[model samples]
Target: MEQATLQTPLGMATILGDRNGIRAIRVTDHSEGEDSIPPALAEACGQLREYFNGERTVFDLPLAPEGTDFQQTVWQALLGIPYGKTISYMDLAKQLGDPAAIRAVAAANGKNPLWIVIPCHRVIGSDGSLTGYAGGIHRKKWLLNHESANPQQSLF
Candidate 1:
């Protein structure tokens, strides 16, 4: 249940983690404290900085998002989305083997707590238009545009 807040391109982000892994990473407009940064928090911040700088993709840090089984499944499916690609909620529902569960899938996505890491931002409307994001559609648009404009360079 450790937390740290830092500024990000889209806004300030509040990162929460425990010894097990990161529980959530939320975007905010301000920081909450000035205490010394914990080691895990610093490491997470470093990884986030690398991500924003376009130097990292596929984060290796641990994560432990709190959610229902269905939500967890939806979040895992989101992880499969490639960095610069986008998918529709309907497509995601189909991938879950329940085409009619598009609304449920969208609900799960809306509840995603890890933000950019779990990449709920990559989910769009059936018309290929950006839709709901807890962090705001503007941030979602910026994230999509950022990934598109800065294609990752392979480290291998």
Candidate 2:
């Protein structure tokens, strides 16, 4: 699979994938000069740049996230979430027609390989608190705020 590093308002993120589709996009602490945006990853990198620039809300690209059936279902459901909206894990569980699977749903959410594209940051705690985020709570908050804000402020 090909890999590339993109610099966003949140930080430097490494996007991994190939012709199959984007598999993962994770923030890393690597230095700036090492970016390697290949053709397969250029679209993703550009879209992510647009996202940070507040010019995009929905993502339209091939995806190939690796996960279990349940996890894949959860991730697909996450894609249905609107850009500026938020949902509680419990609500997500109920949406799946299994309120008892709240924990399982949350676990699946946590395992999402694609970051902003999957919009896992849109999910929060039942009490409306910003809960756990693989990318860090601050980034989650920033993403939610970015999506919700109007006038499309530039974070770069």
Lowest lDDT 10-residue stretch of candidate 1 = 28-37
> lDDT tens digits, residues 1-117, model 2?
999988777888889999989999888655686466799999999999898988999999999999999999999999999989999999999999999999999999999999999
TM-score of 1: 0.91
Cα miss at 145, model 1 (Å)?
0.5
lDDT of 1 by residue, 25-132 (tens): 989766555446677778788889898998987777788999999999999999999988999999999999999999999999999999888989999999998989
TM-score of each: 0.91, 0.93
Cα misplacement distance, residue 103 of candidate 1 (Å)? 0.4
What TM-score does structure 2 among the candidates reach?
A: 0.93
Best TM-score among the predictions, by candidate number: 2
Clash pairs (backbone) in predicted model 2: none
Off by over 4 Å in 2: 150-156
lDDT of 1 at 138: 78
How close to the true structure is residue 134 of candidate 1, measured as C-alpha lDDT? 96
